[model samples]
Target: MTGPDSHRLVRSPGVGSVVIGPAADGSRRPDLVVAADDAIDWTVFDGLTVPAGYPWPRIIVYEGDDTGFFDWARRRPIGTFEWRPSSAHVVDATGANINRLWIGLRTAPLHLTVPSMPHGVLTVNGDLSLLTAVLADGGACPAVDFQPDTLPAADAVPLRLPDLPAFAGAQHVTVTVRPLRQAFDCASLLQFPDTRHLSLGGQLVNVAALAQLRHLRGLQLRFCPDLTGLPALDSWPELTHLIAFNVEEATGKRLRGELRRPGREWERSGVSQLRRPEWFATEYGLPFSGWPAAKAKKATTAYRTAQRAIATATGPDGVEAAIRAFVAVVNAMPGIETTEREDAGDAVAQLAEDTPFGDLTEDAQDWFDDARDF
Candidate 1:
């Protein structure tokens, strides 16, 4: 069997500098090293097989020709593999071999594939049709974090139900297409009613169509700058966790009201999970001053008034009154960012539901505690 120290001479015209070495971590396994040379075709793996007792290399150091390198890597067994595409133009071949690769590696959950391009920005510059083909192949994976390099062109068609069977059983799906100049509708996701968690990010104008995903237990909307409105949540009976970031003020207030009201079954099941936008602003080093003392006092006063109202009122009328009071408190606090207001809204919603304060699971509770300080 070929060991890590074993040397093999692969001679191709104008390719005399290829060097395979031990794993960078100083492991015993060898590293498959390939450099960009037009004379070298990466498809050489088509006729080669892994030698017994010498597993496929876990690390690949390819300095050139990303397109050809990925084409070769796609055919190999998908184990614990890492790639260092040192070239400036690395193109992931997932679109071409996702079906075969995903099927063979279904047992081991793979990290979600993000676009790897010359620029660091998450943008798609190549053929958008490849995405449609890859998803339509119906290879099951647990979770997918898909971010297109760019918005689909005017002539591009929307992805439909039949094209997304691969995600039918997925537990989580996160799609971010931010700063979109044109409208891109993802209403076709309504076909996958089994999807329990849905996260949509970007500048897509409206996500009202997503309300059709009735099976969702958790929903996250992030940095959707143009999303100024939302439809009624009466359709999403199973929804328990709701999160939003960087949404319009009016929309945030309206959602707070809807989440606090008591008669709605969905409203009673869970609370809104909001993160203060100011936290992000501070973390990202945006210009912001601390909240004024007067504004803080006013917000505290509103919160106390709402607590009293909830204590005194009874039935649906009391619930409505308490919700109004909570919204007033949140609106009065200008210092709190949109996300913080959502978190506060969730706290009040839990109170209205007669649930214990800070009743979230350990992980969630920890997140909230951390968010409070951030």
Candidate 2:
């Protein structure tokens, strides 16, 4: 009996045929065998005459002694290659002569260490032998404590992360490449861009091409102060949480009324979760609230008096959109103090019923519904 172990049978690149099987009584038939598409298939068994051109002559015999299941995963790359697990499962596993193979990478120069089918994580670490730069003369992997080595060279240069086709089911992708001053391709690691988290932090890049990543859900941009305005995020309907710090505020009056409001509410209510010493600006510590009763009558009177002074300057529609979007984004963040959700939800309901925004109100209500689920 063959012991527990995996096996491989492969010939040269262009070879046509290879076969393995058992004799009459089926004693220890070379456990597993693998073959090629352009190859011939033939077999012979006891009491069975030489049948010419049998439909599938190759045979895989599993004797009665062992109760084990056989799995076969095959990839045939003829200019087009796919290492995806879903596609790997449907390969033809008809005969014993054609043994089990796995879905793995088969590219020039760079070799891959892919996982077995059904469920396996795909990993591509920075290895010199396994990864080589195509366009540049040569490459270097630097030693940074927190970040991945500088890719090719940082400034305005184009660099490629080797593609991993089997990573279709990946949920999270962490790239060590930091101070990324240039554009990099993440299309391979996150095929379903809307559903996955794409974290880019500690990078020197000014503007990233994240608009192409349509399905991106979570984004963490830290210390990327050079970036002026975030790309159009209204398209990312699936996006739940966005953490941005030190970003330039071209619209200060807008952000003043938006991002700084809910945090001020937590601070006013003596909630420690919203009070971070790192982000504290002495001028920005004033109390603010979304609900009607969080402030006293005198405070509310003073706020409305000041609000009237700026109401004409800050257009009503724009202010409403910013507040609603900000509230939706903050509520989506985990561990957030969810005190004003009912108030916010009621506000959305009123807007939906009475506002001139027909489709926009519906969209806002859907956003709040999803955000409150977190």
| Clashing pairs for predicted structure model 1, backbone only | 123-149, 124-149, 124-150, 275-339, 276-339, 276-340
**Candidate 1 lDDT:** 0.45
Best-fitting candidate, scored by TM-score? 1
lDDT tens digits by residue: candidate 2, 36-113: 211112122212222452322133322121111221212221111112121112222222111222222222134322
For 156-243, candidate 1 gives per-residue lDDT tens digits of: 4433223444445555666665332234466756646677878776545437777667678877776554555466565678777777
Q: Residue 356 of candidate 1: its Cα lDDT?
A: 30
Cα RMSD, each candidate:
19.2, 24.0
lDDT of 2: 0.35
Q: What is the number of backbone collisions in each predicted candidate, taken in the order shown?
A: 6, 9
